[model samples]
Target: MIRHTVGRLVSTVVIALTLALFALPMLWLAAAPFDASPAITASLPQFTLDNFAAILDNPYALGSIRNSLIQGGGAAVLVVVLAALAAYALSRVRVPGRDLLLYLLLLLSSVVTGTAAMVPIFELATRLNLIDTHLGVILVVSGGLLPAAIFILKDFMDETPTSYEESARVFGASPLQILRDIVIPLVRPGLATIAVWALASVWGGFLFQFILLRDPDKAPGSVILYTLYTEGGSPKLDLISTFSLLYSLPVVLMYLFVSQRYGFRFHGGIKR
Candidate 1:
């Protein structure tokens, strides 16, 4: 009992610190736009809404926010649908190179940084006349997300017993019908998690947007934030920070809201 208590204590402390570490930056970012006094500028917390006002008033910032939602939401939906089918196959089928394919998927998914894929992705997009197009950006971002989404979805699907599929088959359910009615409902939580993460990735991403899009109207918030970095003096620090904070708010809100609704759901049917 004493040993178990000590282990639990250690785990609790680690989890608390990990959450704090992640929350600190976002907390600081949320606070910065509200700090107004000069001495406070040195280091104090005087609150004002000017920063937020300035950001919302900026046409570029507003446009970028809208673009981010449309592009990210659409792309994530498309990717999740495609990934669900791919993951379903991976969970159910056995091909000649199946193990090898999965192994390569795990390896590629582990390669989180996408800097190396940019050149070829760009070349292909340009050749296909997809550059500066929202669809193009969506395609590449979805590709990057594919491996991770597959891994997550496949794990959830694998946890499901063969009996479920067998029972469905015995009932004369078509493969498509089984998938739509049974497997999908069973793994909806995993799908939600994948969709959330994918949306965040596309919304927060800058490299692809910066490279693939030349038009300000075509780019997302992160790319617009990059524009602020280049502007140096257009909106002022407080305004820029406020706009960024605003830009981030929707993503943060969605995460918090969805995580609340599906936090445990996302963990269901999976072994720790």
Candidate 2:
């Protein structure tokens, strides 16, 4: 018993140590934007908001902030809507090729790198006359996330009661109306989950926008971060750090707010 207890204690300590290693870097990065003085920037010291202010003051940096919101918001909206519809069909209907289609979606969701098909995607976009535009990036980001978003919502939809749809049908509800009223509400938590996920996913996208978007004015936040990173000669480390922190605020706050409510409970693979 003593040996077992010691082993458990050691395992707990190891996990805590591992978590601390990751947490410390994130914590330091969160604090980095608030340190602006030469001493603070160099030596690592107390917090200040000057870094944030500097980020705002830089016109190009400010544009990046706007770009982040637009891209993230657009991607989130697009993914959630399309995913919800696809998920509903996959979960509730017996459509032909559904399983094969789902397998393809799963494959897409697991894509490791965007660069593998970069040339093809760029060529297609050029043919569609959407090169170097926000729409181009938004579509790429949306399509990339669509599969996972669909899967998540599909799982949730499976967990939802089918009686709701049956009742709606009995009342002569049209399919579109049933989807808008019954389906959307029944799986709102899953939708919320997808919303949070889409925000985080698209916000981190770098390579798609980096290669596809040549217009500096239209580049997303991740691309801006890359540009800032590459311009090591005129280093804006403080602003970059500040922008990173600022960009992270929405998702963190959203999770915190939601966590206080229902909290996340995974009812995996449950079908009504």
Candidate 3:
């Protein structure tokens, strides 16, 4: 009884420490935005709404957020739609070397990341007249994300019972119709997972957007956030902290909504 009590006490202390370590940064982020003279360390905030108003006054700040939503939303939609169709096809169609192809694509995508392949990607975008365009960023980010999205989604598609699809087919449902009515509903959790994943990726994406978009108006939050630093390489903590809070809200809200809806259990489909 003594040993068990000590062990439980130790575990509780360790867990508390871990939670504090994580919570402190969030507490600081929450506090510093309101602090008139925010610092690196968390402290009692001075309490002002002026930080937000100051952010609004910056010509590119709010516009950059809107641009981020456009780029992230577009990329996420493209990734989810394409990944679903590709994963469903690969799941249903018994093509030789299909698994190998999937593995190869996954491997290549991992090995040749956007950072590593940026030169060629930029060249391609330029030749295609895609530079300085939101579509270019969406297309590039979506392409980079597709293999992993497809790989993750394929397992969900595979776990789905084909009997439902067959039944829908017997009832005169076309392929697309059956997919729409049956397969999609079963794999919704996976789709939600992919949507969130894709959105997060594009939301934090800086390199492609920075390199492709020369227009200040087209810059996303990530790029704009980078500019919040002083010319001396020190950060403007007041602005950075405030912007960080605003920058993080959308993704957090999205994750919450999706979690409340489809959840992250990743069950793939209804069990028999």
Candidate 4:
């Protein structure tokens, strides 16, 4: 009895400490942005909106959010739509070595990261006259993400009842119409998952945007966030913290909205 009690007490203390360690930084992140003289270390905030005002005064800060939205939204739409079409086709079709092809594509994409293939990617973009274009970045990021998204959505498609599609077909529905009406509604959760994943991926992406976009005004929040640091290499905590808060707000709100609306339902088989 004594040993069990002591062990439980020790575990509780350890858990508490662990939670505090994680919570402190989050607490700091929430508070520091509002602090008038925010520092690198966490402390009680002397509440002020001056940090936000200061950030607003910068020419590039607020506009970066719009840029991030454009890039993130563009990539997410492409990934979700293309992935849904590809996944459904792959699931319905029984081509020779279909599984192997899917696996091979996924494996290759995983192995060859954006950083590793940037040189060729840059060359291709340059040759195609796509440099400094938002479309170029969207296309590049979407290409890298499609394999994984397709892989994920394919499972969801496979799990859906074929009876629904068959019924739709018997009712004189076309392939596209059946897909639009039956399969899509059923696989909405999967689509939402991929959309959120793709948005976050593109929103946080630094290298692709940095390399592809030459105009500073067109830079996404990820690239713009980099400039928050000073020439001395120390972060300008006031500006950095405030901008970080604004930068992260959209993604967080999106996640919360999706979660509440979709409730993560992949199939009717899975209960909420």
**Candidate that would win on lDDT:** 3
Sort by lDDT, best first: 3, 4, 1, 2
Summing lDDT over every window of 10 consecutive residues in candidate 2, give the lowest-scoring window. Answer: 36-45
Tens digits of lDDT, candidate 1, 1-272: 99999999999999999999898766767678887732223465688887677677767888888889988998889888988898889889988987689779879766755688778889999999999888888888888888878878887787766677789899899888888887887777788888888899898898988899899887889988866644455445676667777887888898887788778364435343
Candidate 3: 10-residue stretch with minimal lDDT:
263-272
What order do you get sorting by TM-score, best first? 3, 4, 2, 1
Tens-place lDDT per residue, model 2, 194-228, is: 87788878777788878777888887677777655
Highest TM-score model number: 3
Model 1 misplaced regions, further than 4 Å: 1-24, 37-42, 109-113, 230-236, 264-272
The Cα error of candidate 1 at residue 209, in Å, is 0.7
Candidate 4 positional error at 164, Å: 1.2
Residue 162, candidate 1: alpha-carbon lDDT: 64
Off by over 4 Å in 3: none
- Per-candidate TM-scores read 0.83, 0.87, 0.95, 0.94
Cα miss at 126, model 3 (Å)? 0.5
In angstroms, the error of model 3 at 234 is: 1.1
TM-score-superior candidate, 2 or 4: 4
Worst 10 residues of 4 by lDDT: 263-272
TM-score, candidate 4, is 0.94
Clash number for each model: 0, 0, 0, 0
Q: How accurate locally is residue 210 in candidate 3, as Cα lDDT from 0 to 100?
A: 91
